[model samples]
Target: MTVEYTDCITLSEETAELAEKELRENEATRRHGLQQVRDWIVKNPRIVHCRDDENFLLRFLRAKKFSAPMAEEALERYLLLRQSWAAAFNNMDCTLPNMKHLIDAGYLFAAPGRDKYGRRWIIARPGVFDPHKFTNEDMCRIHGLVYETLLEDSESQVRGFVHFADGAGVSFPHITLFTPKEAVRIVKNGERTLPMRHKQVYGINVHPSLKYVLDFGLSLISDKIRKRVKIYSSMEEASDEIDTNMLPKEYGGVIPMSEMIEKFKEELMAMRAKLLSHDEMKVRLEMFSEGARVGSVTALKQGSALTCGGRTLDTTLCGSFRKLEVD
Candidate 1:
């Protein structure tokens, strides 16, 4: 039987039990929390424009362990980061030629089935892409597209997911694709900015020379995120941490990578309109500025220091790559 793509994600009995136990999520709690966050959004005037629908708001709530206050903060940051970082968040249309090209290369894909632990696997193979043709920004956009699609499923939002960076054929050109600053910002944002319950990060088949550079990037992230990272010398070692059966055949699973890539492509095509609709979600910084009387729209556009909507924004809340992209 062929697996058809659908937005509704089903969790296994074990995974559902885990969610209730760990995430404090249940039918009753979910209903109450949804209303709580929804009401909070209505009361919070600074949160001007956003996808206030229950599905969208639930992502942040789940990521922040169902805490209304934390979810509000995260949702605000999510909007601010999208507004501030044009390179990554803007133009998230999946049908664009550039995005389709990246998808064709299997640059990054979330596998079809859940692992033994019921967590999703996002396999990233950077070496497959032509570094000369695509810049780091293109890669960032691809990541945005993949994660956006993945986050649609409640399983991914609650049970969380694991990232596998396959370094089988990574070369110097691939390494040079990212500057030191871009590398740091990417690491920082993955942990600090993006609202996802990222469980573990495992790297395998890594080249010896790139280990130091990867280590340097890892050091910039928080200790919690850093500790979730585990690098293995071979697939056998990685299998101890991950269920290889769910990965593509090339990586020791039964399914072909091409099959996963094609399925993912179809999924993206199916989700094109919804993904494009993300462009509609924007944060009216002016409303925030008016409330705080911090800056003008002109100042916000001019990249006023730590100001959004003319108000002082916590530097850490906003993932401005340029601000963090330094030696």
Candidate 2:
């Protein structure tokens, strides 16, 4: 289930009116009062209920005549409380109020469940909020927390783990609507290089909706892969090709002499189509080799073929005796 930041921050009219009264009295007191309100709401036995309309909470908060700073502070506290609530609900079993209040207001769906111990839980699926309303970074954090919550609460539900393909973006499992930055970190750190093992649990299954969001999020990140990086369609394919030197220097792949020469040629071609003079080419080629004569093309060619350089290149073309103008 997904909850928007705005939805989480919504305040009931009673709470809002109380907050407004505090704001009117004193500025410092108002900020503290708002924080107290958030703490109270989280500690309260009842989940906040909205009467009349779903936006009743939002309206109540808006009606408050707080100074801009106070309003912002209150809003910040409200958001923090909501985040805390989400974290708590995900990690621990707690009595949740009737979700129908949120459903009636059009904020979420009521897909409820129970843990192995028969403790009740509710999944908060998002309502009609615009997807673009939140930044990707924000979505990533939210998804991370949500995933952690689901994992802690329903340990039995996680069925298996899967490796993300090279250049493939993955979201945290459990929640399907947002991409997880942790996924990105795992890939970048080469954690996805090997198959990840997941414990088979009774109730765990990947959410279909989360898969959709992950696919989109992955597309966004994959699009950023440089032309130099090769993206594999699947983990199997990536594994088959990946080697200690599979990644680029930027990613810690040890560039071989052959790859360096090819890169040099590509760069040279971009600079000018004409072939480099024998001496000049030898000098540049030596940059990828050990100590060698700068003026001798024959030595460069022979050295390149001998080393093989951990990369597959057709050195024969550069090795042909006819091409070398041996003095």
Candidate 3:
């Protein structure tokens, strides 16, 4: 009885710390949620065998609004999806030369400050996007850095986030040249894998000519996300959802977008070395005895499943990739 009491006290303390440290949920909810997810994690032999057991489980639980079953299914799909895209994902390095070119092109940046709900805001200006200059794979690497650096905050995980996908500068040529399939892959990757609350997506400054691209992209998202999406024909209308005071001057703020982006560039410049170091750590985990291994990326055609490092995943791939030669 004394030992059981001590165990209970220890569990309570750990749960309290979890609440304070990461989830920001109340202690009781944290304890219950963690236990539920933990048990769910243990039951899934695949999850138990994966290196992502530590963070992925909790991330999916919270992302799924703490439904253990849903989170489990989500985790399984996420693992299977990432494993399939070896060319795109294997040895992903944020500091790659291509990634730096995209950053310098002003493709992606975290708009400084939080939204009214204390949520982080990021604006991805794919308007300046040039297919000849980059590839779907490069965008994926940029997203890796975005999630690792900006969206990794425990608070952002709890409060959720909003993105201003400004496609004002994107022409019909840009859409056609890049291919809608690759576009879907880049957009949907966040939906399928990123571990955070995605509350709102504002399609600001969308050009009328590229409405087809918008329509096609919207078709890929579920009704839940579809309803949360608000498309604005003009920047003024989109401002209602964001605090303009927090945005760059281009979007109506005190500072210029160029200045904010330059500051972000400085931060990026410093991370080049760190991101490079991570490139060497990628491994075909299934070949390793103790390393956690998941199945590979399935082909998009709904054909046979793909296998990597002795693990096989039977899932349909949702996106297509183009083989482009980089300059």
Candidate 4:
């Protein structure tokens, strides 16, 4: 029979006593270590069932596997201490983490040290490491989302009204205008017609109460246009003053209303023109020849009851008109 050989492990009495004494003396440290581990586990509950702690212990053992048994035991204790520290902090709160809170707690510091691989560790405060910081792109996304939500909620307040028609003999629909600048092209059901492009016509007669709402909404979208928009009492009066002739040809301005109808015309010729055009083109042209004085013309039926005074003639003659081609 052959005796089996086995390795023997033994601890000296002095060594055992020293270990017990160290454990007793550092009881607070041990407790703190355990708490840290518990906090980490609480904070990262997903990692509780993971092999993280086991992996860390394995790594430590590989590096010091040939060390004394006591050294290995100390390493294990250190890992458990760190885990306790993390767990203690993790259990404090389940709400979203705040970098400011961590910094205020003095748990983090900008210390310079070597990492596990002897590489320089550029330590930074928790604020720098926080992943939830609002970036420029994030802010833009939030702004766009909010704007869309508001637009959808206020859809009823942004309605449109039709005011003018080009009558160009085209298949296009009559040009409609909205008091507010917001307008969109929509197709009717079962229709294959091309979508129409409608332009905003200024100086439209809007209800006083609606006017305030439109002004506020326009200001929210575009302050420049909102400031420039003007509201008038009547659409016809507004159209009559705005000199379509003064505008560039590209803007649909051609002849001035003042020059369109003759001051004195034979009844026969006036009747013939009206019959040929199927619409009366006569307009009474008012001119203020003297300084800020009222003037009137009754020869043409257009301005029979109207009066013009100080700078009104010029102001009316240079107004811009928006031409909308609706379909």
lDDT top scorer: 1
Off by over 4 Å in 1: 1-14, 176-179, 236-241, 286-327
Which model, 1 or 4, shows the larger TM-score? Answer: 1
Candidate 4 residue runs with Cα over 4 Å from true position: 1-201, 245-327
Candidate 3 wrongly placed segments (more than 4 Å): 1-24, 35-56, 177-189, 262-327
Clashes of 1: 3
lDDT of 4 at 55: 21
For residue 152, what is the lDDT in candidate 2? 25
Candidate 2 residue 43 C-alpha distance from true site, Å: 38
Residue pairs with backbone overlap in model 3: 83-296, 83-297, 84-296, 84-297
TM-score of 1: 0.80
Q: Write the per-residue lDDT of candidate 2 for residues 288-321, one digit (tens) a residue.
A: 3221111111211222332324644343432221
Q: Can you write out model 3's per-residue Cα lDDT over 1-327, one digit (the tens) per residue?
A: 111121232223443344345544554554566666565444433332443332334567667666555555555545544554555554445456787677777788877667666677777888776777766666566766765565334456666777777777777656665455556655665675556677787778787777776788888777888898888888888777666776778778888887877787665656556544433333333432221222221212223333445565543221111111111
How much does candidate 2 score in TM-score? 0.19
C-alpha positional error of residue 90 in candidate 3 after TM-score superposition, expressed in Å? 3.9
Greater lDDT among 1 and 3 belongs to 1
Ranking by lDDT: 1, 3, 2, 4
